[model samples]
Target: MDIKIIIDDKNIKTLTYDSPVLLSRVIRDSGCGFSFPCSGKGVCGKCRVRVTGCVSEADEREKKLTGENSAFRLACLTKATGDCELFLPDKNITALTDGLCSRYSHSPFGEGVGAAVDIGTTTVALYLYELENEKLLSVHSFANPQGIYGADVISRIEASLGEEKEKLRALISKGLEEGIAELCDKANINKEECKTAVVTGNAAMLSILLGEDVTGLSASPFTLADYFGKTVNINGMRTYIPRAISPFVGSDITCALISGSDIMKNEKLSLLVDIGTNGEMAIKKGDEIICCSCAAGPAFEGTGIRMGAPAREGAINRVWQERGKIKYSVIGDKAADGICGSALIDSLALFLSLKMTDETGLIKNPTVFEGQPAIEIADSGVYITQKDIRSAQLAKAAIRAGIDSLLNSCGAASEDLGRLILAGGFGSFISPENAEIIGLIPPGTAKRTVAVGNAAGMGASAILLSRQALEKSEITAKNAASLELATSDFFMKSYIDNMYFTKKD
Candidate 1:
């Protein structure tokens, strides 16, 4: 049987199979860019694709998720029985690569080209540099293909423990290889000249990349297989993975701190929060640094929520009120297909201000969507349901509790902090005022919040350029104290207290 895969009216690949085969399997085998946000569990209904010719009928689960629309079928549930043409969604995903890097003198170790890669769970950013002169040559970024496994680290860890372990490793390895190739193409340099690469990410991410067993991260104790701070050979390329502070708090935070070192240099107390699937935050007062990780879930990144997506084209990134009506701005000015993290915060804030939702996070007089109460955002068929609100509440509460725990642990409060730095792509575009309104961050700290774009990538680039920055990352990981939030009574209390929409002093 021949299966044709199409993307944007282009015939991307043709796969041959002997018997019935899953469409997702064919796409994955073909190395095509597709997302199975639920890890092909037949849930989420995110992997929608058009199929023509012989295929299995949509099951009850697929029909319920896909609704009355018969034009598309869930890729995970649909199987190509014979010759079929499968169409995938647009592959143009937006990822943030630009970041703020603290200035440091260059003392590079390599002579040829070097690459700095930040392997984020959702996205990957690679920076290519001319090592001799310490000049940046090119940058390349892409949505992490491992997203097919699932959106959160927990999902990835679960996949790593199962039969898909080697598959997970291959996916990330291919992404990095392809990323380096693209970087070299853009820089007009020979690929062999790229002598060194500095890769930084959370501990689980690095473990999966290195093909290390992730069983330690699945249960209590959360033991890390490797606290990487050494060089390893990746596909014959000399690669360095930064040191991780804890099992949950990985090297990404360490690199982000290195890129934004000035935040700690100031005498006033400061907090750095990397808001994503895992809310890893650190508080620095003088020489003392303390950090913790909170499972914020994937709500902030637009996963697990119905009609939620990443900050891609057609995604609503901002929301406001105009003439007593909800108004929103979409990326690329495209039709709003779904809401991302920024718009989620904005919509929640607007809901509270309009009294559409109460302090308990209840939707007032909501309409029904597939039998669930939902609040319609515009007329674009995008709605936030009661369950989605709960997801957002859980995510925001986790982050809020984390901030308070870190502050209290350091014997400080939100007001006492001179600066609260927000790192990563989602952090870069969010409105701090809206964040406070939704109770995602503490009240007074919103005024002091600063979004430092892709600090992890900045730190990776710094390490590639300066040896001193690499040494600093090691020291930061060694000296930092890890706070176990799962075992903290204060975090549990604060988490429940902040679950409500109302602000509590």
Candidate 2:
């Protein structure tokens, strides 16, 4: 039977299943953005959907989760028996870096136009550069359709080994193709004129796109990955996938080095943290640059919380304490949909200040509530649950621990750094003060921290434009060293000690 899925106030599409299937499976196969924080274990009720046709009865868990009076069904627990229409409820996400970018000019040697792309696990940004004229033809950004498979590289790797690899490959290819077409149309340029695309992503994404076996990249001792390091045709365009340094440290970080070379000059103690699902960091001490990848997961990007989402319309991106009352700011100047990562970090800190969450990261409200662990926000069915706190704890611990590990690698401490660069969009949106309060960033380094928005994309554009930038990326990849954090005892100890809302006393 065919199930018609309709996003509220958006387009509609119909898909088929040969037999009865879990709604979560159907949704996963659809390549749409929906939260499965518990990996569809039904423990987290984030995947709430409204169905309007033949569907099986909601179980006890669903009733307890959404209440008997509510019409929403847990997509993870519900089963679709017949043709039904369902709508996924999430504020439309329109995310691109608002942080200042390093300067770039499209100066490719050839006359043809080129598309520079940075395919993040959760988002994708494309820069259409006019090579000869050194002009930016157009820019387009969108969610990575493969996000439906999972939110992190680990999950993506598991799915890629099975039949789902082709689905992921096709989704990303289609997104790239559509983005190119959209940029060309927006700039009134012919599609044929754009014959080249320079793409950079982590090993998982690159492996899937290049149709290479990802076992070496995903399995234990993950030190192997194929960078292709050559040009190949993908969706009618000659795409150049750059050389990667390791399974975890991808070409994206190599590009970031090119973008942040100003701060990365020799004889300087600097740290670059590209915060994302994968926390990729590079610490420069003199001539050598040590890089490490921490599996930070997607909690920082707002994918794992009960009401978590991207920084978009209605997402509460900031929070503050005002006259003994907490105040918050939502993106797009709209009603609060969910608290984004930056705000969530701020909220955690705020809660700690207000004695809502203790130093041990436990929520203790003065007046007891039915949901023992959740702090309800404005009674709009939005909340920061206990699970959300634990997710933040894990993610922050990974990132902070990774930073400590990197610093240890270079025989330097956080106080020795002259500068700290936080790349990627998430890094830019975050307030360093709030981040420090929550122990996600070093407290002493807040003053010198700089968030260069989407440095990976900026570097990709530079590589597309200038010969020097391209050659620099190559050298950076060749010279960079990757550290395995899981093998470090200090990282493990730091992770355990840093799992609280505040630093260990």
lDDT of 1 by residue, 1-505 (tens): 9999888899998999999999888888887767888888887878888899999988788888888757999888999999999988875775688888876678875678999998888888899999888889999989888887777888889989999899989999988988899999999988888989999999998999999989999999789989999999986789889999999999999999889645667689989999989999999998999999999998988888898999888888888899987888888867888999899999999999889999888999899998899998978778999999999999999999999999999888788998889999999899999899888888788888888888999999888888899999999999999999999999999999999987564
lDDT per residue, candidate 2, 1-505, as tens digits? 8888778767567889888888888887787766565567776566778887788898778887677767799898988898888788753555454333355444573457889898888788888888887678888888777766666777777878889888878888888888889889989998888988889888788888777788886667775556555678888887777778778888888888887445566367998898899899998888788999888888888877767878888888888877867777778867786778888888888888778888888888733333546886544445888778898999999999999899998888888988889888888888888888889887798897988888888777777777677777788888888888878999999898889867784
Q: List the residue pairs that clash in candidate 1.
A: none
Output the lDDT of residue 135, model 2. 79
> lDDT (CA) for every model shown?
0.89, 0.79
- lDDT for model 2 comes to 0.79
The ten-residue window of minimal lDDT in model 2 covers 97-106
Q: What RMSD does each model have against the real structure?
A: 1.5, 2.5
TM-score winner: 1
